[model samples]
Target: MNASAAARHPYLSPDAPRVLAHRGLVTPDAAALGVAENSFAAVAEAHAAGVAYVESDCHLTADGAVVLFHDDDLRRVADDPRAIADVRVHELEEIMSERGGLITLAQALDAFPDVRFNLDVKAAAAAESVGRLVAPHAERVLVTSFSDARRREALAAARSAGAVRRPATSPGIDTAKRLVAARALRRTTRVRALLADLDALQLPERRGPIRVVTRGLVRDAHAAGVEVHVWTVNAEDDMERLLDLGVDGLVTDRADVALAVVNRRGTTAV
Candidate 1:
């Protein structure tokens, strides 16, 4: 793909470098702030802090409602032994009521109408339902999963649910590995082939010290009109370094600090 064809999907913000709240900004010391990961309060906090994209994961409840949560069970917030899929949405909501309010997929979209969401389908069973829910709101969502099959299934479900425009998507683990191999071989054609319907390459800066987000990877991904977003980046220094390295976005638990780092230089580009 040529440079012009490498233009990103319109679904992504035009802002040169994006900052995304990973699981809605629940810090390691969240107890002090009384917010929990994937909680309504956490998302609200990110929104109040002026983050444009909030990254979250989805799982199914016993009643089959799709919810914005990261873990498979209630141990983190409620300390309950029940799995998320084993309990109904309302029950989980009640369990988390005092810690950080819980909200359904529909409720999250409705509550934060102005925000763009980067959703990860964490469960295979929730894939289709998640797709259907995000279909009408396709323009503002980017759906993904570590499981590539689940990722594609979710996208297909969204398309089947009357979405004229498919939601933006990031390549899952296997697809990303292919891109890595192509990058290693300096094969732009192969890289382009992998980005067919994808909008971005969202990845970690390093996978167990293997160092995934090299300058070449960023350049190649961008060359194919796909953006590169590094994940779970925290600390002001790392944020600045990744931005300096030309990553198109940062998925962080500290959007507050990341935003300040980017805007400090007044229109820093990645």
Candidate 2:
């Protein structure tokens, strides 16, 4: 079990390098495939393919229900310009019925009893609700966001909801920048401090043209007992390269391909 780095956060699979189905497998031909991102059908498809970890985002609806959705509004999926926060949960369901059935946070949790979810709290209003909803299943859920304040707010809410073990988390955008600086300066103390409570560094392989994941950063994170995971990595060659480079997880839109790559790669030396 390569679980030492994430020992505190057991949601990460130890048997193999992790593969997180980013928004649940909306492939390159998503419209043709009829796979809607963050929809129940997508998640079901992921599980059916034997993928264990699913990464999704959360937003609150007008009716106060927390949903597994990605966008601020229904523009892309439903072709409606109305904001998701302006629509009720049932209304959102109806909007998504044909593309892919929408699932509430509670329903997702209840239904996928064995799956580990990496949930991004996309909306500020949904932060507290997300934390509370996942409190009981803290061990099986990872909570994160781009905003540090929003991310911490959700974690704090989870703690207030009586979560004993902290939910696994990644640093937000601001915190990530701080980490990058600390790494570049080789400030071991600052890097350790920045990574104190984090389980993984979930990042894009690059931010614009600046390469975000590097050997130095990965080494530093590992020395601090944290794992590095790259997001939305899609291509087969890219998957093999990143895994070979020692990323602990891959958050990908092509989980089927990722899984096959991981299997063929077959636990290479870390």
Candidate 3:
């Protein structure tokens, strides 16, 4: 599809689950793959691969600089273990990646102007900042957080600023279950109401005794106008099963492998 056509389709519209390059599609063997999770180089690599949407984590530094990174603790990506919120952006910048630079969210967006983004905000304060940074390309962006409060706050900020489109909703499953349970207290109220408000529902691959991506869950979600996107699915068999269950999207570290599987299935059918 063309860029505009692609932009109009929500990620889980059942037409085709667009491949989102998780952490920008780098493998462990690449020179820069494991250097940092959401670096500019990673995003550039995904764009070069022609993936329309890339996912990244957003965290703010002490001095209020928004950056593209996955962890609150620097240990995973930096030499130090300081909390990301405790350090200034300048201080963090001085601690270079093995490749020798830190990537700001602005830089990543600027580098790939046409590519869409899935911004997973890691902090409440970072939400408005992220909304502001991505507002110019709001149609091509979807802001999400494990925190419903943060998602609501970000959407409110974006709307107040006169952003043309409100950020899509992605409410956590835990919150949804609570809402569901509360509503069950009332007679004849449908749990689907809570599900419908969300653009997508993100739950653990398996929650408690029930599998989150079961055929039942997918049917219920689709019936309620919500889409199901499972996370961090790494195994090949698990990927196939999720596809069979009709999940709207699969988030994986191995986007290349996932895309290959999807393509192979398509060719065989043809």
Candidate 4:
């Protein structure tokens, strides 16, 4: 349930169609990869290599500064173990990786002005900050989150605070489980809410014991005007299987390989 565990088990289902480069195409097996994950350098690498969308995680610092990061704790990327929200942005600014220094959300937007971003807001309150940070480039960004409440909050903030349009709602795979948690919360309600807000559903390939990305899910999502995009797929066999199912998008660490597969298939490129 921690970030490390989540990172190890990316649930990319078979229903999605497009390829979203995870951490800008830095493979886990590589000894010396590109820039650190979620950094501006990584985003730039993805864009320069013709990736359509690059994904990044966002969290707000203690001082209300929004920045890019994946884990709640800084241990993975920094020497400290403090929660990202607990630290002031200035204090966290000292954190750096081998590729380059840490980058602000605004800096990323400025650097990749034309590239489309898949912004994953890590906290509910951070929604407003994310909205403000991305307001100027709303047309080129797609905001997503594991929390529906946070996504809605972000949408509301964007509409009220800026002229930026609400980015399409793409719920994380984990939200699907909330439907089964309580009787008061209808499963249909969750589906309908997702249908209303999202143009696509960003799901892992698997959901608990269930394979939610079956052909039926794809057909159903598409019927409701929602595209399906799976994430963090690393195997060629799995990739081929998903492609056979007519997914809308794919999120992979190997963007170049996925692009090659799609190209070799001779199917129309997304």
Candidate 5:
């Protein structure tokens, strides 16, 4: 574990380099045992592996239940041809029962009371409900979406629901793009302005050939009181390299492996 940085927010407290289980953990062994991503089992396994953070996407069912799921349609995780918005909560639960178990936003929060969640509001329709569900638990939840408008909508709803503390947030695609431009131009004031309301800069390491999480980018993000977290990194070498680059977090499918790497580095994250 790296030395703890100054706490930026409650969600980011004890600010050491950390690992966020991407969609929870579905290791090769777990997958072989019929586990599925974003299932309750996946998150349980990550928790069992001692990971403190989990990243997942949220969608709303037809009956207005917020579920931890990725795609709009069921074609990928479930072989069903229907859209999630067309299915009732119980029906979706039935489908997920065999594949590890359905994990609603509520259930995940309740079950993993000690873990922090980084939830992506995947659908515009699910945004408000996701916010409402996460409201009371706002201190441990981070609401985000690719659409800046959608992300803000959820945050607004959380406030409406009387969140005790504002949830942590990351920039959407547009804001991230603008931030990158500001960074490239060395506009110090503009960079801070762009990050004024954000807690983390969660991003891909690169966009095609354009590297997004460069040394300077990491430095600037840290200077602005935001932590930089790279997404979808699974390989051990990549994990090691990114940690060396001074990233604050790694969003990976292999939290188990990440923990091992972190341990090997002699920096166990609290």
Candidate 6:
């Protein structure tokens, strides 16, 4: 989005070349201290490291609570065979207590009032609740999902919750794909149409073999008053390269390093 439009959305008002901590930050030291991805500790680490945004995912528990977790099951993080939907919120919290301390969507918003959240609706069941939870904090939250319908559902829920300002959002995979195709074909009209409603285009630098976040795409998105944010980028060199290409933001596991890079460049959009 343009500077003024972006400034109107508190979540995007920060200076360009933003860095979003992907699933929060878990350095070797933090991991050694029992901090886990998407855990409260991880998010706290990112916040302490001075990241403007924390990217996370949400799921619904059997008790209908919206939690900050990435996977459907606890296998990788908890070593439990049960799925998140099958467990009660209390049980899940107990399990995460040892890993890094579980954090509900409500807790995250309330505990870190100044931190902006980039939430992905990982479960359809959590969409409405996520919407409801973030409604009060719409100015500082960005709701997203791989499913456009789910994303829209959460945004609608936020609106229904009486949020005067709509939460910021990025397009889902389907819309992103169409936008990419339109960009590749050089259809300015179609590209603008695709980006009209989006605040950011969160994407990979490349999808399989085809490059997704090219300069042309970034330029087109910026021209349409949208920002482009590349995801899951971790390496320092790659972060610098992408920034040099004029991307508006980077979603990285290493917010620590990204912050350092950005500082060295003086917050310039590049």
lDDT of 4 at 248: 71
Candidate 1 clashes between residue pairs 3 or more apart in a chain or in different chains:
6-225
Q: What is candidate 6's lDDT per residue for 1-270, written digit by digit as tens?
A: 454653445678855788899999999888888889999999999988888689999999999999999999999997899999999989998999988899999999999998899999999999999999999999999999999999999999999999988999999999999998887788888988998888889999998999999888887877777888999889999998998999989898988988989888887421
For candidate 5, lDDT tens digit of each residue in 1-270? 222444577888776778999999998987987788999999999999999999999999999998999999899887889999999989988998878899999999999999999999998999999989899989888989999999999999999999977799999999999999988898889988999899999999999999999998888877778889999899999999999999989999989999999889998763
The TM-scores of all predictions, comma-separated, are 0.94, 0.94, 0.85, 0.82, 0.96, 0.96
Model 4: per-residue lDDT, tens digit, 199-226? 6667788767866676766765665666
| lDDT of model 1 at position 242 | 86
Query: Candidate 1: worst 10 consecutive residues by lDDT?
Result: 1-10
RMSD of 4: 7.5
Clashing pairs counted in every model: 1, 0, 0, 18, 2, 3
Question: How many angstroms is residue 253 displaced in model 3 relative to the true structure, after the best TM-score fit?
Answer: 0.5
lDDT, candidate 2, 1-270, per-residue tens:
233734547776464578999998765566586668899888888888888889999999998899999999989887899998999987888878877789888988899988899999999999999999999999899999999899899999999999987788998999999998877787889998999889889999998988999877888787777788899888999988987788888999889888888878765221
Question: Runs in model 1 with CA error above 4 Å?
Answer: 1-7, 27-30, 268-270
Greater TM-score among 3 and 5 belongs to 5
lDDT (Cα) of model 1 = 0.85
| lDDT-better candidate, 1 vs 5 | 5
Best by lDDT: 5
Name the runs in model 2 displaced over 4 angstroms: 1-6, 27-30, 268-270
lDDT of candidate 5 vs native?
0.90
lDDT of 6: 0.90
